[model samples]
Target: MDSLIKDAVKSGTPIDGADGLLNQLTKAVLERALDSELTHHLGYEAGDPAGRGSGNSRNGTTPKTVTTVNGPVRIDVPRDRNGSFEPAIVPKKTRRLNNINSVVLSLYSRGMTTRDIEAHLGEVYGAAVSRELISNITEVVVDEIKAWQSR
Candidate 1:
């Protein structure tokens, strides 16, 4: 993939426009971030001697597709035997990327109900974010909204 990027760069391929190289780049970066998060949560990197025969280890990965502005990106989410690790970059059972939180806020600010937003995401982004998930995501922005309003 590195070589492919290098070739594209050398060939003067434009980096941006729509459904271009940036989407793939975003996917790669997100996957790497998830892997790093897992490594940190485990307290031992994969293949480390300490993790060998330990009570828990990397079990495998589950394919998860996140909806991005670029489009849908499929990523292999790393898993552990204990299943205790919850990814901060993209939480479990949440299909949309964290980047879409702003869009969620914007829609909610426009007086869109949770159900409305949920259906919109399902139709547009192909994400099945639940009402509870929308509430949790919007709850974070509630504080931000208060702070901004006060200012």
Candidate 2:
């Protein structure tokens, strides 16, 4: 990990951005986590002889784009032939990850408008989030608060 950080710095890779070292690292980590999930589901490591007679094997991975606190990361999610591998880290059919909704809510609580939050995401995290999406995230929190108050 130290070597990778040194190499990235030597190459002048930006610390944070859409195409920066952090984004690349996040992608690598998420893909690795997904692969680990698949291995746990299948009960064998990739290319292990123990999986020879296994009824279910690893299928090719499917590419998925998910939003994270770092930015929008494109990761190849591993799949299983049995079609039962549900990743706990990223999950299936879910795009946003890494508590990004929490970030939006925190900003909203600090009196940042949806438009301001949208721009902040784009500028800081390289995420091109729309105002509507930010508003929707905040609205969910507002509704939850309202429900809690009524109780």
Candidate 3:
């Protein structure tokens, strides 16, 4: 692990970008977590004898592109024969992850405009987040604040 980081640094790899070390690390971690989730759901690891006669076994994986804080990561989400394995790290049909939302909200709280947040995300993280998406993410917090005030 230390050698990998040293090599990445020696090669001038950027910290955050599509092909950067952080993105690669994030992708690896998420994929590993998803595989763990599938194993838990199936009650056995891949190639285990216990999975031979199981009603629901490992089928394959589906390619999914998820917008994460590092950038958009293309991961092969593991699937099951019963089609009931739902991953909590990258939930099904969730294009954007929560960390990016938190970043947007943190920027907004610091008085950055939606457009500014959009440009910051694009420039810093290489994530093409639009102003509307930033607004929508912050809107949820706004609603919660309003509800709290009303209460």
Pairs clashing within candidate 2: none
Candidate 1 local lDDT, 40-100, one digit each (tens): 6777877899888778888899999888777787889999899997875578998877664
Would you list the rank order by lDDT, best first? Answer: 2, 3, 1
User: Residue 60, candidate 3: how far off, in angstroms?
Assistant: 1.1
Tell how far residue 84 is off in model 1, in angstroms: 1.3
The Cα error of candidate 3 at residue 3, in Å, is 6.4
> What TM-score, computed on C-alpha atoms, does each candidate reach?
0.56, 0.61, 0.61
Q: Identify the candidate with maximal lDDT.
A: 2
Question: Which of the two, 1 or 3, has more TM-score?
Answer: 3
Scored by Cα lDDT, where does model 3 land? 0.73
Q: Give the per-residue Cα lDDT of candidate 1 at 38.
A: 75
> Which sections of candidate 3 miss by over 4 Å?
1-4, 99-151
TM-score of 3: 0.61
Model 2, residue 64: displacement in angstroms? 0.3
Candidate 2 vs candidate 3: the lDDT winner is 2
| Between candidates 1 and 2, the lDDT winner | 2
lDDT of each: 0.71, 0.73, 0.73
Candidate 3 deviation (Cα RMSD):
14.0
